[model samples]
Target: MNQQYTIAGLDLPDINPEDKLNRILSSALEKTNGYLINKSTSLAHYWDANYFNLDKVQIFQDSTPAEQSSILQLCNLGILEEAYFIEKAGMGYMAKMILLAETISERMLYGLFAADEVTHFSQISSFLPTPKVSYNPFLDLLENVVESEDKTVLLFVLQVVLEGWGLTHYRSIASCCQNPHLKSILQGFLQDESRHHATGVTLLENRSLGKSSQNIVEILAMFLQMVQLGPQSVVKAVEQVKGHLSKQDKINIFAQLDTETHSGSRLKLLRNLIDLPNAKNILENLEMKGSFQPLKPSQCVSFNCS
Candidate 1:
């Protein structure tokens, strides 16, 4: 494994996890007025009240109380997913290879990123109503990818695609949520994710793939297809959580999710990825293979674009 990729200059601000944790704790204390409850460990103290807007989440609002409870349970599955990835990064075969293939500076940066992810997982877990679970389809996909022999593929899939997806989702959550403390925490996570995505993009662009570019494109296509199918899986998971919702409620939930997936901040983030030079090159290569059709700028419209 050649760990010799050119390092791109990244002008990221210094991040102090302790300061972030302190701010989160102070904010939680202020919100609770010093009366900490069982779940008031951090800014997550406000998660139940402001994390998901019940009224705006029309499906959750219209569903029966039991159905709503189950849906909320499905949503918090992210906490477990994050924690699983952190653990996998430490013990998974691909993660070990990736670390070994990195320069010392890159390794140090990855260490910081891992720490940030752990903080994110712990903060979210603090407020979750359900116990930590071992299964998440997306995380499973990630684990499989990490086992691949091509470390570049693993880097692109996890950092560029998955972390970019997270950055986009977190930005949307921060924008819409009412709690300042929660927003602050999300913003910090967003900064780290942005750095990770940029590093992946730079590395992918700098590498001389030659014949291997085609294989990478195929892998990216498959990963994109998986991402496209994610919402459907989420809907199924939410429905399976309790399984007593009326058919109409399920239909409504699916409809709302479809609309959000197509026109919301998530779509905006995916579209932005297409504009990346490396992503565009891959798309072009795929187009040449008759496997994909390149989208015109007009066809790539996002909610934030205009």
Candidate 2:
């Protein structure tokens, strides 16, 4: 026996009579593929390490440009692949929110979002020639939250924090992207995503996290933990070119990665996003406990943040 799995399966014409209605209902509900990605026949787009600002980082400065580019190409693919799957996961979670929604307007918003997620999944998946799904911790986190959390927490995490954070992230990537097509796709996403983030903010404003407060904090902490991990991707990228690394190499790379500066910026973004009236007390509580600090290289090295 063999099995295949993907949201792309959503696009297939099912043969089963039992699934006939399932196919019909979902087909009308989703905009999967959107036929937009195939609108281009451009050649491949290579990675530009400048996206990570690697030139300013001391570690890559010593290596030749070719070596730096080699590592960045691998890292870039990893970033794109992660985005593809995360967007694919959104196709489910966004739709799931419809049933859990408190208002008809909210349900309608998620209905539209289901289509948006499909479009996003379609666009990003096109960039990969062999589009294999990969392990992503954040995707796992997203799935778990969607499966268990209520509408209020869902709005805050998925829309307010993730989408809000994503606006800046996608902009940075699109701004540095060498491929015009991919850049435009990302930019187009920003318009829709900005609205999505704003909707989350509007829905969540002054709305009590209530019993979900602890859950929301835990989720935020897990997210901030990712921030704490710093730029280990840069280290992994270096390993791609140089192969095998000693403890010292990793430490030196952390310095060059400027973990403090990079991590601080992300934490600031989260803090900005978390500034909700209802969540103000929670934010303060997290601050009191020093939750916003970046992970020192020592802590990551000891625990192997990888």
Candidate 3:
């Protein structure tokens, strides 16, 4: 059964921004740091905790001087790129919602906003000094897989792979969160991301590789490879934070961070949800069962648009 999924499948509602709690959060973040963009595109949706109170989120504001410094730097990076990415992806997600999403429910909408922002926060907070990789190696890989046959391939790369990884990270952080409110907020977002990931996988997987305009097998493989590599920088950052700690402090801090990161359902979501039976089937179809290859942004295509 070869078929193409259209935006028509998406039942996105025109959510009034004033009604959303996340939008209120967006307003808060903006007050804290005004650089965060607030626009949503036809292809993207923006949801942040400023609007919704799915769970009362306790702010992780207190920290050791070092931890505070580290976190501030992380927030700085967000001010530079993460905020923009959040806005950009939000626009894209909204566009997708309008195009492909079915009737939006309160749960589903809450999920969308929290999931997207949390994932966005996770990536930027930990991976500072974002690399200037010309082509976004993953996107390059996607372009090569379809070989220019479709623009939708870009959407798949961002939505399915990049955002999928973001969901996993959010779950991890949420589970590890010290503040109960923050944890609850993250959990709510994870639920939304689960649906988003499922939608992406189902849309791509049900269609056979040959029938689709792009190579489904290759796309799936590249996504998995990209996912494995996504954390190297954040891990490096974490190690840097640990390096400054005394041996005993290191042990305590590491334990604390580990608890925050590897706790409960977060670990399960990271391992099981991402490595789903369907995702595994797609990977096998792509013949990427072997270890994933490390990526080089330099080898990717260069942008020379005048």
Measured on C-alpha atoms, candidate 2 has an lDDT of: 0.73
Write candidate 3's Cα lDDT for 170-251 as tens digits.
6655655444644565576666566666666665554333333235445655455444332223323333553543444433
| Superposition TM-score, candidate 3 onto the true structure | 0.42
* Alpha carbon lDDT of each predicted model: 0.51, 0.73, 0.41
After superposing candidate 3, which stretches have Cα over 4 Å from the reference?
1-87, 100-164, 179-181, 201-206, 211-214, 217-222, 235-282, 288-306
- Greater-TM-score candidate between 1 and 2: 2
Instruction: Residues 264-289, candidate 1: write the lDDT tens digits.
Output: 44434554664556556776764465
Off by over 4 Å in 1: 1-62, 77-98, 129-135, 178-180, 241-253, 260-268, 274-281, 285-306
Candidate 1 RMSD computed on C-alpha atoms after optimal superposition onto the true structure: 10.4
Predicted model with the maximum lDDT = 2
lDDT by residue for model 2 (1-306), tens? 111343223223322436556466445435443443332222243456566767766667877877876777777777786677667667777777777888899899989888888778767766764445444567667666766647788888888999999989888888878888788888888888898899999988767788887788888888888777787777777877887888877877776667878898899889989988789876987787677898776665555545
> Which 10-residue span in candidate 1 carries the lowest summed lDDT?
3-12
Ranking by TM-score: 2, 1, 3
lDDT of 1 at 47: 36
